[model samples]
Target chain A: MFVRGLKSSIIALESNLKNRTLFFLLNFVLLVTVFIEILTYKHSIALEPHRYQNFTDDILIVQMHYDSETPYTFSSIFDRKLASIENVLYTQYAINQYIYNKETYQLSVKIKGTSGNFIENYDIVDFYYKTNGLPNVKKNELIYGRVWTNEEYQKGESVGLIYEATAKTIFGKSDATGERLNFGSHSIKIIGILKNTDDIKNYYRTFNNYNLEFVVYTPITYLKSDSLIDYSIMRSYNNDILKEIITNNISEKMYFYEREDVISKTLDIKKEQLSNFYYVIVVTLIICVVGLFQLIKNFINQMTFECSIRRTFGATKFEIFSMLVFQNSFVFLLALMLAIVVSIMIIYAYFYFSYRYVYPYLSYIDINIILIIGIAQLILTIAFTTLLSQKIINTNIIDGVKGNS
Target chain B: MYELINVSKSYGKNQIFTNLNFTIESKKFTGIFGESGSGKTTLVSILGMLDQKYTGNYIFNGINITQLGDRELSTLRKEKIGFLFQESYLINEITVFDNLLLNVLDKENKQLIKRIRELMDKFAISDFLYRRVSTLSGGEKQRVALVRALLMNPELIIADEPTGNLDKTNSEIILSYLKSLCLENKTVIVVSHDEKVLKYCDIQYNLIKNGKLERCL
Candidate 1:
């Protein structure tokens, strides 16, 4: 019986061009709404500053203007006695650099440079592992070789440490200590090989300019200092007061990227995007309902005679309902499929054309929300048509047939 | 095979049947005659189980129809009866073949298909089988309706003004088919204003006279 209705539904769809177009429009609105919602949610989470791997919440990343050749050296101003409040643990900056391995797989790994071991002292490895949703990851341990002394970093030595696997891929050995690991045209002496974590596949992830997959502390002189941002971890008895003091004392000329501030701003952005999508949904629903009512009016005018004929010929009322709903359902599903394809294409075209860090955030989009929306739309349509079709079903058969005469 | 006791039906201020009692016997051609406003259509609808909203008890094949719900009444209409109406009453958009198959589309099989072919052949409408109903002549459409009415091998057939749109020749052809069903032990009730067609009925009723069988020549 449903099959019969389905076949008739196809014919019904083909008969009315207005119905088909309206149906498509209604479904397109729903599909675009859901896709936009998912995109906004994923992009908001991705835009969160934690992805930069800033493990030390006690830190403030501040960048000031600099000339290409003259990077500002972190020195106290004796003229203002600024040395009284100087608590910079280390002067360092990190930048993202792409590494193409032997297989030509490009991975964006952070190149961190520091004047001291501020990274190891604050349990950077443990913090990154914990933030990455793994609580039991091993602590940062140098499997081989010694750490570069402060003198080496101050003298601008071109030296670094790498994860064991990264070392093997670079120099064909896990223990590549004392060997030169060539990155682009520059060679860094492998002073240490950090014990690789299980999640080396996450080399693309960064924690506040620190590579979560491989911890490579090179000399500051090796990095393009002008393209880097300076970050310093403040130490004080009360961390909140120190953060407040630093925020107040920092020059307005510096760009501040405080984690708390960034997180809050990103959340506001997420909320704004969600509210925009909701408005789109409401506007589309209103248009769709108006269109549906018009469609129902047309159905009553056109389908009354046909339904009467079927009823007179032995089709039960329920069978008539099935036929009607299936007819509309056919058009609804077709529109839904078209909307899905179009929404995906739109997202792809937008993302692929942008020069920013592109991620296929759609791949990890939350699907339950989409399903809920689809089901809601289906129920709304079915219920609306059901109420109207009931009138035709319960119509006086004699009057219906005779009225057409 | 059908009985209606004290059935009174009204459409708001307009009353159609007022405390009318009627009965139809099995395997007979019953003709119901009445004036235009005397409610011949309303009477047939009640007999056809299409209109059950009446103040009466209806027993068909020994089941109380007045007690049945819409679904049950619909099942009775589908299984035990068939209907023919004036104005061709065929779905004009679909093909003749599709129109015939609409009611039995779910149970369509070799046997049903062969029966449909045989009926079309018998009605001399086999040539127009695949043509759309909208394109068929009035006589051709009525013949198709006749074939559809008997396709289910129903126990009862109710037709209201079945020949109102046909000419003399076409009218005779349709009336002859209704008469022939009686020989096969099938009951047929036809409501028509034509005295010429009333001559073919084995039993006759006058709805204008409080739903009594008139026994008219």
Candidate 2:
């Protein structure tokens, strides 16, 4: 009886493939919204860690036009105002350039030229761990060597970290921590080794076409100048007065945003997108629910004669209702599977084409959101189906045989 | 033997039966003739045990149907009776063999296959074994439905308007096959208004005016 009834249900599904396809496509749209929101979040965070707990709301990031005339860049006014902003916990500089050097190093690093200013070009980030943490990792990554000592950060040391693969190719071993590499006039010592994971390689894809994360960690003082400073970050103490001072000083050449300003701006856009998605989800959910109800109504009405026929052949009400439940539940399951497969394919395709690698983006996914949506969808299906099975069981066999609803 | 004693049924305010009584003997042909909207369908349902919403003592094989629950009633119906409706009642999208597979006690029983094949051969429907029910002509479909009705090897076959959709030649063929079943010690009860069908019944009843069951003189 189970096999026979299941077969009939499958035939019913196959006969109504158009309705089932519509159902699957509606659910697919809902899942796409969630996945696209997740991808957007990944982009907003510079695509490294899932959580950015260390970047508190009070920290201010100042950006200025590099190579601007005198007193217009952070390397001038901002550097001179450092002492006045008292009780600030930490201050850092971001000065990066791409120098296509053909020396023994093949390095993309730029440092103090003969004029004590950075040479401008494209390269990886050179940052010293201001919190005395390992600069090799962003959040949850593990690296090979050690973090910088307090003395190294305070004394403006010229030591740096290199990727393990880069160290292997240039210095003959992966553990060449003490080895010195001459860049133009400097012989910076390698102090640590980045783990050289695929995530780091994806990070390199954002900058140059090189597949290596040739990052070097050094003190901010090593690359600073009174000329060009890419950007500067500092912990807040008296930032309001400092902002007033800086705005009054360099408002034409620079802009400053606190962590709250940046995060709120990203969140505002996300909220708008998500609210629109909520409407789509709600509308499609209404369509899906109404569609299933109407489908079941028609199914029961059309199958009334057949149900009576089966009943006359000694089929129980239980058997008939079981067949109905099996058919509806099967369609719901098929739709859910369709959504999962399509969403995964879309994410993979986007990453593969855009970044040439999908490894870094994988680390930024919040799977709980996806699972919650999936489970919620399943619950809706189950609830709607079971609620309607009563109508199926209660259909009058006498009326049914006579072709009555 | 089957007997209905002091049976009464009603729908809200309108009543279908009030203390109606009847008896049908085993291994004999009984016929019921009624027009549309008459109480013949109600009586058929009561005797078929497809309905139980009535006050009656319906004794079938010496067991009262009123004392049975749905499960026991379903079991009794499935194991003891076979029903042949007017429309053939077979899934048109499936093959004749698959439709027959729905009626047996155990679908996997090997002897059941032999039994089905034997019955199909007896009815001259062996050629329709793999054909979808929808593709067959009306007469062919009715023959296949007859073969399905006999799969459970039940003692009684209740055929409700078994030839309503058939031409005269095909109707005669179905009625002849049903009448022949009584010689095999099978009790056949057929309900129809067609004079050609009710003529074959040994004991015939008429309900043409939608009233109490009255024996046709």
TM-score of chain A of each: 0.46, 0.46
Worst 10 residues of 1 chain A by lDDT: A91-100
Off by over 4 Å in 1: A1-138, A141-281, A293-301, A350-372, B209-217
Q: Report per-candidate DockQ.
A: 0.48, 0.41
Clashing pairs in 1: A52-A207, A52-A208, A53-A207, A53-A208, A54-A208
My TM-score estimates for the predictions, one after another, are: 0.65, 0.67
Candidate 2 lDDT score at position A358:
32
Q: For candidate 1, give the lDDT.
A: 0.61
lDDT of 1 by residue, B94-191 (tens): 67877777766466667888999999999998999888788999999999998888888898989888889999999999889889889999999999
Candidate 2 residue lDDT tens string, A1-405: 677455556555543455555655655565565555554444433332212221121111112122223221222323423332211112211111111122222222232222111111123232222233554234324366664565665565666666676666555478878877444244467777767665655543432233332445554444444222223322233456445444554333333211123344555676676666566556755665566566555555565666676667777777767665666567656666676667667765666666544344454455565566667766766676566666655666666767764
